[model samples]
Target: MEIDGQPLWVAPSIYVDSKEQGIISLGHRCVLSEHVMLLTHDFSLDRYSEKMGIAPSDMEYETKGKIRIGDYAFIGIRSIIMPGVTIGDGAIVGAGSVVTKSVGDGMVVAGNPARELGTVESAWERNQAQWQLKRRRP
Candidate 1:
């Protein structure tokens, strides 16, 4: 569900890591592009093999966290939103970036690790500068 007066758009192909605890959340008017992956859990087996350690499938409780995308946030295509990430309002995440840490409000972050590039002046300006609201013909 979307917050009042804020519309959320997520691509059809967006994949959630798990069907059960895929507790990825969106505040309002968030835009998630194609093939975006919301990763909610990480397995111990990924680090420790079954030969030496517990398998990921065997583990019941794993490292998991919720992802919160604040209002008006734009997540670019094919980006991976890791567990325990909070993307603040009016933030712009560049394409194909891996978000490891929380992003502050109105911040523009891009790259492999997704570092801070700059801050947006205002929500109005950020929306105007970055995205557009267009109407389709009937």
Candidate 2:
């Protein structure tokens, strides 16, 4: 596990599987909320078992790859970041997201498989507008 720079916020409740040989790198100012899971390895027991004509329980096969979270990336609570995923700089992952692929810089992604919703700047602007509206309400 390699964490670079200062002021990175990783919640204590988050689970990071570091037993595999693959590296897990967290960049500057990255924030991992509670219950976030960073997986560096994926089990291939079913596929291996089928190929070998054996029970999945009897098979011990895994695919390992590095997980890199770029600078200023924010992983929301209960999100799962799969192996070999490189979250780009300034990316925003919505809560409970299942990230299966790499996120582009400043992109905002949400839901299972984590599809792109919009850019960070647009989301921020929307948020600001909502805040202003709320302030005007009684």
Candidate 3:
């Protein structure tokens, strides 16, 4: 819940962790879709101790890294944002993407491991064409 700026839209089912340092940092104009999980840590069985009566499922594993999303980034539905991920400005994550690494500025990523598909330049081109068509339509 550490939002660094304003005009953010987050879906209801987004799982956000705010306990650790920079666990979730959302810049201005960021959009998080439904069921998107912004995780900071992973629970491991090694943390469990039999003598301490701690169950493996009850072990707590803290975040070794942070999740930072820059301005104007859009995280699609059901996306899993792993720790230590810095998403640059204007980046777009497609639906159900599992982001394991940092995404470059204005890039489009999708699928498991979130491969870079293209850049925002393509989107800008499409937008320009639409505008031209509208102007020509009278």
Candidate 4:
């Protein structure tokens, strides 16, 4: 587990799995909302072990890989970042998203498989417009 800078906000309920042979790196100003899960390992081999009638503790059933959240990345509430996933700088993961692949810089992703929605700049623009509209309402 390596956090690169200050002002990294992580909610209390978030879970970071760093017990495996991989690294979980959170970059500068990264925000992890409540119930966000940063997973560093996969249990795909567990089914194989079950089929072979092998004891769980007798074999290695976990595949580990690094999970990197780049600078200024925002992981929304209840989002799950899978193993070997790298979220680039300024990327945003929408609430309840399950990120299965790498997200590029400034990209906004949402949904179960976390498909790219748009860039961070677009999202910011939309937010600003909404705020301006609200302020104008009399």
Backbone Cα, N, C clashes tallied per candidate: 0, 0, 0, 0
C-alpha RMSD by candidate, in order: 4.0, 5.0, 5.3, 4.7
C-alpha lDDT values of all predictions? 0.81, 0.87, 0.82, 0.88
Residue-level lDDT tens digits of model 4 in 21-66: 3398888988899999988878887988878878455666778779
TM-score of each: 0.76, 0.83, 0.75, 0.84
- Model 2, 36-109: lDDT tens digits are 99988877566867677775555567787799899999999999999889999999999999999999999999
Model 1 over residues 11-93: C-alpha lDDT tens digits? Answer: 89988886653366777788889998888888654655656555655655468888888899999999998989989998989
- Candidate ranking under TM-score, highest first, comes to 4, 2, 1, 3
Query: So what's the TM-score on candidate 1?
Result: 0.76
What global local distance difference test value does model 3 have?
A: 0.82
lDDT of 3 at 92: 92
Q: Candidate 3 — which residues are off by over 4 angstroms?
A: 45-63, 126-138
**List of clashing residue pairs for candidate 2:** none
Whichever of 1 and 3 has more lDDT, that candidate is 3
Residue-wise lDDT of candidate 3 within 18-50, one digit each (tens)? 576556788998889899998777644446553
Off by over 4 Å in 1: 1-6, 44-49, 53-61, 122-138
